[model samples]
Target: IPTIKLNNGREMPVEGYGCWKINYDRVWSLGSWLFNDDNRAGQVVLQAIRAGYRYIDSAYFYNVEKGVGHALRYAFRTGIVKREDMFIATKIWNNFHRRDRVVEGIRRSLRDMGLDYVDLAIIHWPMGFEDGDDVFPMYWNLSNVPREWSRNGFVETWQGMTDALDMGLAKSIGVSNFNIKQLKVLMDSSKIKPVVNQVECNPYYNQNKMLEFCQQNNIVMTAYSPLRQGYDLLDDPNLRRIARRHNKTAAQVALRWNIQRGVAVIPKSERRRRMNENINVFDFELRDDEMKAIDLLRQMPKLLTFGTTRSHPDYPFHDSY
Candidate 1:
């Protein structure tokens, strides 16, 4: 229930639900099935909304836009919540980097979500390569870099995004997966500074320097993968011990740690009980020593550093993430 004030004069929730790995088998039965059942996906979103979650994070790359859109519509129709009460966020995929195509992509997402406008829109990734003849190319394949990269296309795409804000298509705009150098370039060239930078963050991979840079620049940082893709932070002895001392769940402890550091977090879950548990963090507070103990737990490597991707000739993180 905590909120952060954006540089654009809007308040965003400090914690929210993320739908990155949500099951999409029912909607699109494509290759490498992770999980199925769109009904369950819709229910999870509805439950999150009912549990006082005002912010929902999603992306075109996730391929579950229909389910999220359906859930939002159903929730409104059922009187669970009003449209204005929710902050719906979606991202532009890497493939749509050109100026005209970026606008077309947002229109397609608006059509898919059945919404007039999104509360915020983010460029999904810094790389802007086209997909090959294959539907989904290998992570390392970079055969088709967009021509715009040669001509500073990101600046043009950013201008289109700014136009989206002026045209009332998106209330705010930002970037994702950008390193310090790329972020600085955008900041220098952009007429409207990016209000948020979504990136991978957690106790294990705390981005102190990046967080400080964004803080100094008035860009809110939204921490994705806060639990490291459910890599057992909830069961850590240190976290459990701190949770017991504060009478809170280890998950809440992790979330509170990020919120206290002034970084927004989006922890995803399908279980209704866990969804409720994740949102119930406003009641209790973690002590200063406990917060420091959690901060000290930042020994793990970055989970989604862009350098790992094969597209970049210079992967930026050779020195640090």
Candidate 2:
């Protein structure tokens, strides 16, 4: 696997396994068990590592770090891989943005993942929610904003993240779902700059301007939903045509496009075969025309807008990136 050199001098894998929506409770369902062939997040993560993925992306919101940690321990015991080589990353949830709560948030995630330190710790989103035990505090519906918002600004939350770095809880810290303006505010106020900005980037929502901005600032841009989470991009005729030319799946082509653009992708999948396919794009390179053809998809609507939080003060999608 290829690695991207982060601003903090850390090397991160360009392709990674995303553990987002792999709910621990849902793994017991018949569909999950049948397709995944493993009922635990650890099993799935183990399968991913076996499939040649070196980067594993997880988060507090995913609620499966314990299972993921179980897999990591098993892998280590069996000599499948070493902890230092595997780039493990997690996020600080919105509810833990206060300077005082920041250290506690990462500590909880570390305890859940059974790790002394994470390769990367990211601010999950720019917005800060009511600080409490609830993940989505006062969130009763998806279509409306939450009832309460945290008074803690992202800068304050970043101060807590810096503390985590100072205390050796996280190797490097970055942000997710932040826009240009938000990035500037944090960059201006803090001495340590963000190494990367993770967001929902795919063919439909290309994030061209944001990519340019991050590149100019020497910040790597990571794509979380690189495959759009479903068949929408895979089924497109243009993408399929390019895939056929390269003898790769549309999913591979989609991922390669992001990789060619210098963006790291964390595509999630429960099946082992798909995991293999996702990490097998290093051999083939998309031609210039092929990349431009995929670029035509920039107009497609965003799949994960997080629009319900549009009214929140820290909502990132409100700006035109």
Candidate 3:
């Protein structure tokens, strides 16, 4: 796998596994019940490790920290991968954005994951939500509450994030779901600038201007949803034509295109074959023309903008990129 040097001089794998939208059937069902079913989630993590995936992305919002932790401990005990070889990344959810609770939130995640520290810890979203809806145990619903209620708290929360790095609970810290303006606020107020910004990036939502901004600022950009929520880019005419021309899978072609642009990608899958296939983009390269063709596809918009939801009052869409 290729590597990108972060602003703090830490090296990160260019392509990793994302464990978002993972459902643990026993613990969660169609309605409001919580149970325990760690088998499938545990197996997926182990399979990812066995398939040579060194980087793993998890979040408190995912509600599978214990399962992830159990799987990691099992993998290490079974000699699947060494501690130094793995890069584990998790996030701080919105409700814990209060200044006092920020560090505690991270500590809780570490406790849940059974790890002392994580490679990268991110503030999950720039905005915070009220904690009542039970979307995830830690998730607060922002569906109706406006952004103004949480903006100040969000900044305070970031200060606590910086403090986490100072105290050594997280090696490197950053933000996710932040737009240009939110990032600017962080840059201005922070003692340490965020080393990375993870956001939704794919052929449909290429985020060219955002990418350029982060690149110019020396902040690493990690592309989540690289396959567009499995919307069948693999069978799409343009991507498939490009894939055939380059002798690659559409997924590989998409990942390779992002890699060439110096963007990190986290494409998720539960199938062992797809897990291996997602990481096999190191050999092939995309030409300039093919890259441009992918770029043209970005003109068609897809996916929700991070802060543009009706619930966020200060959505940065009008003011910033």
Candidate 4:
């Protein structure tokens, strides 16, 4: 796996296994945790690690940290990888944006994962939801009604992230789903700049300007949905042409496109075959024209807008970036 040097001089794996949408079955109706001993999620994580994945991207919102933790423990005990050998990155959820909750959030994730510290602990989203146990506090018990937003700004949350760093809870800190404008505000107000800005990026919704901005600011750009979940980016003619030329899958072409642009990617897959394919992009390279051909797909509509939170004051996608 290629590595990207963070602003803090930490080297992060260019490609990682994302843990989003894992163990959703445990999240009964999105209301509570079942707390069963089903380690299916951990087994998949272990499989990913066994397939040469070193970076594991997770978050409190994922609700599978315990399973992921079990896999990490099994790997460590069985000599698959040491704690320092893997780069584990989790996020502070929106409800945990308060300064105090920021520290608590990471601690919770650490506790769930059975780790003392994480390589990277990022703000999951710039917008904060109402602080409470519920990830999404509903309004008037109506699921479709507008969710409550927190008054606390991310600047305050970043301060807590800095606290997490000061206390050695995380090796590096970052923000996710933040636009260039929001990043500027946070950078201006905070003492330590975020090392990364993770967002949805792929051939379809290529974040060209955002990537340039983050690169200019010395921040690493990471793509969460690098493959555009549920959408077949592999069906695109340009990507298929490039994939055939290299005898690679279109998914490989998409991931390679991001890697070639110096953007780190965290593509998720429950199946081991797809997991192996996602990380097998190191052998081939994309030419300039091929990269441009993939870039043309940026005209397509973005896959994830998180439009439910659009009314929030700090919603990021409202900006052009």
Candidate-wise lDDT, in order = 0.78, 0.86, 0.80, 0.88
Backbone clashes in candidate 2 total 0
Segments in model 4 whose C-alpha atoms lie over 4 Å from true places: 27-30, 33-38, 141-152
State the lDDT of candidate 1 residue by residue for 1-321, as single tens digits. 768899999888888899876664532232243556556667778778888898999887676777788889999999988989888888987667667677677777888778999989998876665533222333435343443435345676788788788878899899887778778878889769988999888888888888999999999999998878778777789999998887888888888888989999999988878888888888888889988998898467776664334444423455464
Return the TM-score for each candidate structure. Answer: 0.90, 0.92, 0.90, 0.94
Candidate 2 global lDDT: 0.86
lDDT of 3 by residue, 152-210 (tens): 45677788898898888899998887888788888888768898999888887798989
Error of 1 at 295 (Å): 1.4
Cα lDDT tens digits for candidate 4, 67-117: 999999999999999999999999998888879999999999999999999
Every candidate's CA RMSD: 2.9, 3.7, 3.0, 2.1
Q: How far out, in Å, is residue 226 in model 4? A: 0.7
Top-TM-score candidate index: 4
After TM-score superposition, the amount by which residue 283's alpha carbon in candidate 1 deviates from its true location, in angstroms, is 0.8
Q: Which stretches of candidate 3 lie over 4 Å from their true place?
A: 24-36, 131-152, 305-309, 314-320
Tens digit per residue, CA lDDT, model 2, 93-128: 887888889889999988987899999999998888
Rank ordering of all candidates by lDDT, starting from the highest: 4, 2, 3, 1
